[model samples]
Target: MAGEHEHRDVSGGWLRAAVFGATDGLVTNSSLIAGVGGGGGAHHTIVLTGMAGLVAGAFSMATGEYISVTTQNEAIHAEVANEKAALAQDPVGEIAELADTYIARGVSPATAKAFATELAASPKDALHVHVQEELGVDAQKLPGAWTAAISSFLSFSLGALLPLLPYLLGLSSLPVALAVSAIALMAAGALAALLTGRSPIQSGLRQLLLGALAVGATYLIGHLLGAHV
Candidate 1:
């Protein structure tokens, strides 16, 4: 039963944001570095570009995560409030609605009513079921926007630093920088794959390919622009 409940749990608000921030920061900053260097830009320019990307990307990820999570939580809370109000004002009707929902989902009429009736015995349980059914949002494990923001900020900064680190440490060659970036991206992807139950090798290769493509496209465009300028 304990193990079964584990699968039913919904959580990881911060973890999701952090992982996103880290992966995005790595890919985005590496691409910027590759693009600048590949275009025959100065080494200093690439370094500076990487730094700028890191700072801007970290802040952007944090702000975006905060707003997104906050808005979602607000909406869910609002719905929960509405459901609670409905239950308080018209519990019988609420029970009927819950019964209808269960019935629609394939429970027999009498069984559904009985189930709803049992649930409605406790107002809290009734509200919980109603919220889950009507809004499809979890009230017990609500997401925290601040947590998301902090995770994004910290993880994105750390990830973006990976590519920039070698450059900062005086490895100025474009090829070397890109090489490090590829390896880093692959490792990150592989690690992330573990969480998703995917093949690490396949996921790593996929991320490496995508990162390479992005760098190549940006490099081509930057090179063209540099030539004209």
Candidate 2:
């Protein structure tokens, strides 16, 4: 009997949705808070706006992930079913097809022949291997809707809470609010890096700089527009 090997996949629906949702929530909500505050909105009004943005953004992310993952899963299943049917209807032709594919990819004829022979013995496993290794598709991991929904909702909620820090703490100035927003974004990036196994320093610095630039630009614009008015 052949020993089974554990498969390790780096990409999936949950990872994609969680990462994107968190990043978007952090950046978008932070910018929204800063821009609104810079435009001279009251603290309570800013908090309400941020809360609305958070809820709307989370639902939007979840819905979008659901649609995308569902479409991809259907396509992968359809392809696998078609391949299975083809293999069942014509074993010899399927073997030739597999061999030709390997040969086109620079495998030697002898090696391709051996591979084709062994694969023909277990056509379903062979098909799965081809789909995974050759085509980079994972039919088994077709994004659970609940997982995507929860991750997106929670990520956005967590990220959106950052902008509310200054108001919640009763800090009474635009500068203080902006500072809190910057710190929140930086912390979010650090956490993201820790989860994703990247360099915390790099990620934190990137978010910090981006948030600062956004606040500065918006502050300037708001000041100019206020003066003109």
Give the candidate number with the greatest lDDT.
1
lDDT of 2 by residue, 124-167 (tens): 68778667754577776567777877787787777666666677
lDDT per residue as tens, model 1, 145-227: 89989999999998889888877988788777778888988987887775576799998898888888888898888888788
Q: List the residue pairs that clash in candidate 2.
A: none
Q: Model 1: what TM-score? A: 0.92
Write out the backbone clash pairs for model 1.
none
lDDT of 2 at 38: 69
Off by over 4 Å in 1: 1-12
Model 2, C-alpha of 89: deviation from truth (Å) = 3.3
The residue-level lDDT of candidate 1 at 153 comes to 98
Worst 10 residues of 2 by lDDT: 6-15
